[model samples]
Target: MALAYFVLGDADRGRANLRDYYLAIGPDHADQIARSAGTHTVALKETIESFAAIGADELILLPGLDDVNEVDRLAEAVL
Candidate 1:
């Protein structure tokens, strides 16, 4: 959503946090995983926009160790 981008300006930072949570909790922590992935989704859109706003030629998304569906949704929203 545009509002997500409006709030979080940096995707990289958001992704980092997501990775940290996942690493700490591992795959079995569904509740915490959902929360982290939700946050990551918001950050992903912001990150793409942030890069676009800076005039990047190409966008590369690397959603390391996440809920694939959640990541797919975010990627669809962004690209």
Candidate 2:
């Protein structure tokens, strides 16, 4: 499975959430899962491109929180 976190400007928020998620899931594969998150627009875009390069048919962006600004942030960065 693939997972990501896209934040407007507060990368720390995303990292913190990722950390919580990591802890909740246990630390056995933390290294791999931690690297899978994208905390900002540029990183998100890069991740999308990287996946596309590898022939990904679709991409899904899951929210880390309930903030609506994330939609605008993502559009500004990727759309």
Candidate 3:
């Protein structure tokens, strides 16, 4: 599974988005899936590094909120 609803600096926003996502999808394994999301920059970076260590060829990051600035924020944090 890919990391979804990630916020570069705002952990609270990321978590809120995850909650909303869970409510919308109503998945049976919401708790498990929540672990896949990155709630802050450190968590996101760790997730990326872990994937790389496992020889992952690509990783997808889904935005936590509808903000175009998120792109720049991610770039600033991870790029």
Give per-residue CA lDDT, model 2, range 12-61, as digits (tens). 67656666777766765554455566766778889898878888767887
Q: TM-score ranking from best to worst? A: 2, 3, 1
Clashes of 3: 0
Task: Give the per-residue lDDT of model 3 (tens digit) for 1-79.
Answer: 4444466546566656666668666655554465566766787788898888887868888776677888888877787
For candidate 1, list the clashing residue pairs, or say none: none
lDDT of 1 by residue, 1-79 (tens): 2222111224355545554655766755533443433344456666666767877857655443344554555556666
Local distance difference test, each candidate? 0.48, 0.69, 0.69
Residue 64 in candidate 2, Cα distance off native in Å:
2.6
lDDT, candidate 2, equals: 0.69
Position 6, candidate 3: lDDT:
69
**Model 1, TM vs. native:** 0.38
Q: Least accurate stretch of 10 residues (summed lDDT) in model 1? A: 1-10
Which candidate wins on TM-score? 2
